[model samples]
Target: MSFTQRLRRRLFPPRDAIEGYENEELVDTICRKTAAYQGQANWPLVADLTTVLDFGGGAGVHYKTARQQSPDIRWAVVETPAMVRRAMELATDRLRFFERIEEAADWLGNVDLIHSNGAIQYVPNPVRTIRSLCAVAPAKLIWHRVPISEGEGRREVQTSYLSDNGPGQAPSLAEKLVRYERTWIPEQAFIRAHEGYRMAERSPDPREHGTYQFRFVPD
Candidate 1:
């Protein structure tokens, strides 16, 4: 058996597929983000009609539970073609997946929510990525789990084995081949130029990744 099969068998005896394991992996994110949006008046969620674009959303397991909590919401996760294929298979009336963020351009100024959790760092050019997101002009943006350097804002391309979710039972089981990723500490100028939004909140991620979460809202 593969290492993943062995680990899953040993770690999650009752879980039959990798998808089931992914749901468990994203449970905390679903719970915490759901709670944050539930009490808020703007993006990420709306008690009434809502639409969310989850950039670099993988498999979209995080949205699975969220769909139950906010049935009135429309969610689209933009990911790689392979991930999009799998997530698309699980799509429902309230949830869908896309291969490109630009597909939701029609939602400009009305998307309600845009979220990118642990995503920007992997983007080739985060500035360009955020610009595209800003163009969509959602009411609120959830920028979470972003690793940043303390000194200056610079882009980096590093090779490392990355995992989909948090490290599971045996971290080695989920390590992908060596891959290069670009990350930035994020300069303030980009958000400043966006015009309609303001950085309303900033907080250190509770985790140890030295990342910060920023929330942008209508100015």
Candidate 2:
């Protein structure tokens, strides 16, 4: 919170590159959310499954509700190495974290569901990641808040305030700004990337502009 740093942030904003997403405040918030998560509309989907591969599932917060409903559910989260280190604090017998998709799949034995929320865009290569996820051959793949394009895919920078991730925090000028590069995958290209999977559901995400949710199943 130095004067120079504050001034630089005002001028440059959140466009600064993020490395491993290691923000301490954000980590605290994720841990708190993981501890207190009640549920979401997708709770039933999670509750019905016994094993899941969560891509970009920060600290595996979504497991809270699923664990409540299906006590034996094994949830494996695939995240960055830095995040894996921080998220290990919340790991338990049924919950685990890995830095690679293959490792997660190996640990889970059989993945009933693959889930990702607002995460694909942040990856360096969405197509490569999608291919990796497909290699797991999960029964179902769900993506929420995926940025889609009607034409050729492209990269863009997303800037947001830390409070955006908070349920109770108020916005402030001093709130830390975050910027990350995202790829807007072409609609058709994205759909075709899953070699043997068919797009079971595709719909616009009500909360995010130009983004959609998708569900894929074996063809």
Candidate 3:
């Protein structure tokens, strides 16, 4: 496995602390906002969408919010085993869960949409993966990823909490956002790899952190 994949497996171990906090209302709100933005940008395409594949779907939170926004939409959450189990527990008829992307691929001949949030950064072959997914689903692809930029270090510090102090005992939030100073791919590289896709929009996070939203469509 690649370093990125290994890091994800370790940091986001099946049912870790982060998983426990995923169902919070704030998380739900953010997901809803993201889905709304995607819908607006790809409104014409999504209007006819009935089934969607939520790739790297974490605990089915996004799926839940998406269902509320589009009741006629059916969804399948594709994630790692740990997340898959959590999703199954939260599953409804319109929302199902799968552990592998290939499993979901079998059910979708040409899906209307693909929702991928905060997951592709760990993919070793992002270009190939994107192409494969796009080939299987020609409608629309909404991918959100963290951008690597200059001035930040690539190492992230993580803290482990030990037992029983009061609420005050909780450790300060570890700086998990590592800056990949030299790793930012140039726009040309993105254009080259993502051949048939046109850059519809590029929105950078206002916090000065390197996260960005690049909306694209197949040419």
Model 3, span 105-205: residue lDDT tens: 67655677777766555445555666666666446577666454444323332222221111112233322222111234344544455556676777774
Of the candidates shown, which would achieve the greatest TM-score relative to the real structure?
2
| Stretches > 4 Å off in candidate 2 | 1-20, 23-25, 36-42, 166-174
Ranking of models by TM-score? 2, 1, 3
Cα shift from native, residue 130, model 1 (Å)? 0.6
What does each candidate score in C-alpha RMSD? 8.6, 5.2, 10.8
TM-score (C-alpha) between model 3 and the true structure: 0.59
Off by over 4 Å in 3: 1-48, 149-191, 206-208
TM-score for each model: 0.67, 0.84, 0.59
Model 1 alpha-carbon miss at residue 162, Å: 6.8
Rank by lDDT (best first): 2, 1, 3
How many clashing residue pairs appear in each of the predictions shown? Answer: 0, 0, 1
lDDT per residue for candidate 1 within 125-144, as digits (tens), equals 77777877887878888888
In candidate 1, which residue ranges exceed 4 Å CA deviation? 1-49, 105-109, 155-178, 193-195
lDDT (C-alpha, whole model) for all candidates: 0.61, 0.82, 0.54
